[model samples]
Target: MQHRPIKTAVFPVAGQGTRFLPATKAVPKEMLPVVDKPLLQYAVDEALAAGIERLVFITARGKGAIDDHFDMASELVAGLKARGKTAELASLEGTCLEPGRITSIRQQEPAGLGHAVWCARHIVGADAFAVLLPDELLWNPARPALAAMHDAYRQMGGNIISVLEVTEAHTHRYGIVTPGRSDGLLTEVRGMVEKPQVGTAPSRLAAIGRYILQPEVMDVLAKGRRGAGGEIQLTDAMAELIGVQPFHALTFEGTRFDCGDKVGHLMANVALALERSDTGPALRDWLRSLEL
Candidate 1:
């Protein structure tokens, strides 16, 4: 079957980031620096790489900083250009968001992930769309995780969520997929259980942050049924679509970091730091010095 094109993507960034606390008091956690870039920039680049034209950010109050991040820095760009700082100009240029290509909706309440996604339904309209969780930093050399999934989406439609093998012990932390047949690196999803009990999991394939879902998912999320932790969960709504739609899981070639968690945040920074040309050698030396 010829898969439908994905023109838009929904980014849910409404969380209060209470986990990071004081530091996140004024600064949005998405703006927290990871090496040279912020968390949200990584997600935005992933969406753009997947040929997404419209970017919808589901935000809450005090998220003005995120909106400002992509806005044109006219005076700053001009100053850099006047000083013949070409590299600086280039850095600012990459931050530009095409006029009107970006839009925001207030999630208002600190509800579940499903509610946040539902807020952006109108922006996504009636078509297949990608949804990327900014906290999940997917690193890839060939194609970003979303782009790889889009490639799979060319053959399979309905809903495509990225899956990575997580330890059975960690299954309770993620939405685990019950695998059916394998399609290249993609797996046909027989069903999904959000945070299933240990030893009772259908499979070790845990749902990551990337997803290419049909607009029909909007209908499911609209019902806003509270799940898991009292908030309406996205996983619960996605579970409702399994057998009904042609759902599948794409095994993306990338290392994913749950940047929302403390340990995961530290891991992403250290891993990316070691990948830098100038810092790689020194960082490696430091790691060797630690000796475990």
Candidate 2:
């Protein structure tokens, strides 16, 4: 059977970045820069690279800056053009979404991941769409992570989620998956346990932020049942779709940073900076000089 092509992607950016505190008071956490570009930009670029033609952003009241970020900065572009800053001008390329390719809908309240995703139901309609959480930044420029999952979706023809092995001690921090039939990086997902209790956890393979879900998930979320943390959890909705549809997890080949945490954010910057030819030498020198 041919799989429904994933032409649209939903970005759930409505969360209040309470973890970042005062810095996120005025800015959305997704707007926080990794090196120079904001976290949201990386997620958008990844979606576009994976052949996603339309972007559906689930945002809240304070996320207007995100809307502005994707809009063309005419004055700034003119300034760079006059100065003949060719490189800078080139850097801004591919930042703007063409015409009607992007849509943003408000969540209205701080519900949860499932609720945030449900906000884009009308826009997503009845198509298979990918969901990317900007907080999870997967670094693999050679082949974008989402593209890999899309490839698996074509072969497997079901819901595909990105998974990574975490230590047993950290199992409770993520949505743990029960492994079934395994084939290299791809594993058949028997079930998913959201933030399982430490001792009772199923497996070490934890689900990450990437997902290619069928439209039936919206129907599950419509039930409005609250799960862990007393909020509507996306994992809960996904679990409902497991038996009804083919569900599998892909161990994405890449370095994933949980940018939602302070340490992870810092690590992403240092790691990406070290990979840049221009900044690597200076950054390496500075790091070596530090007395840790």
Candidate 3:
């Protein structure tokens, strides 16, 4: 079946980063820096790398910083250019989107992931779209995780979700997928249970933050039925499409860090910092000297 091209992606960033406390009180969690770039920028770059043309950000109140982050910093760029800061100016490349290529919609309230995604339904309009959570930072620059999912979507053409094998004990923390047929990284999704009760999970394969969903799922979320945690869980909506639509999970190839958690956020920064040429040597040396 020929599928509509996946040209757009939805980023659900409306959540208040209560986890980060004082730091997030003034800034959106998505705007928190990983190493040098903010968390949201990494997700945007991944989407762009996957040939996504339009970016739909589901934002909430006080999230205007995200919109400003993507806007061209005219004064900053001019200052760098005047000072002959070619390197700084070059680093800003690809940060700004083509006018009209990006759009932001307000979530208004702290709804669940499903509602946040549904907010972009009008903007997405009949096209298969991707939803990327800024919290799950996949560290695979050479072949972005989303790009890999896009490749699978082109071949399978239904609903593609990125999965990772988490420990059985940790199944309750994620939306676990029951495997049907396996073909290396691609597995037929038999079913999904959002944060299933302990010892009740079917499999250890859990859905991460990346998803390429068909537009029909929007109608399902439109019902506004609450699921786990009293939020309109996207997993519940996607589960409904499993038998009706072709749903498959791709075992993503990369190290994923859940930056929503404090420890995970720190790990991402240290890992990325260690990979940087400018900081790697010094950071590695400092690490080697650690008492722990």
**True-structure lDDT of candidate 3:** 0.94
What's the distance in Å from true for residue 189, model 2?
Answer: 0.5
- Off by more than 4 A, model 1: none
Q: Report the alpha-carbon TM-score of model 1 versus the true structure.
A: 0.96
lDDT of 3 by residue, 232-253 (tens): 9999999999988899999989
- lDDT values of the candidates? 0.88, 0.92, 0.94
TM values, all candidates: 0.96, 0.98, 0.99
Give lDDT tens digits, candidate 1, residues 111-172. Answer: 88889999988888888899899999999957899988888788777899998998989999
Model 2: lDDT to the true structure: 0.92
Candidate 1: clashing pairs of residues: none
Off by over 4 Å in 2: none
| Candidate 3 error regions (>4 Å) | none
TM-score of 2: 0.98
If ranked by TM-score, best first, what sequence of candidates would result? 3, 2, 1
Q: What lDDT does model 1 reach?
A: 0.88
lDDT of 1 at 24: 95
* Model 2 residue 239 lDDT score: 90
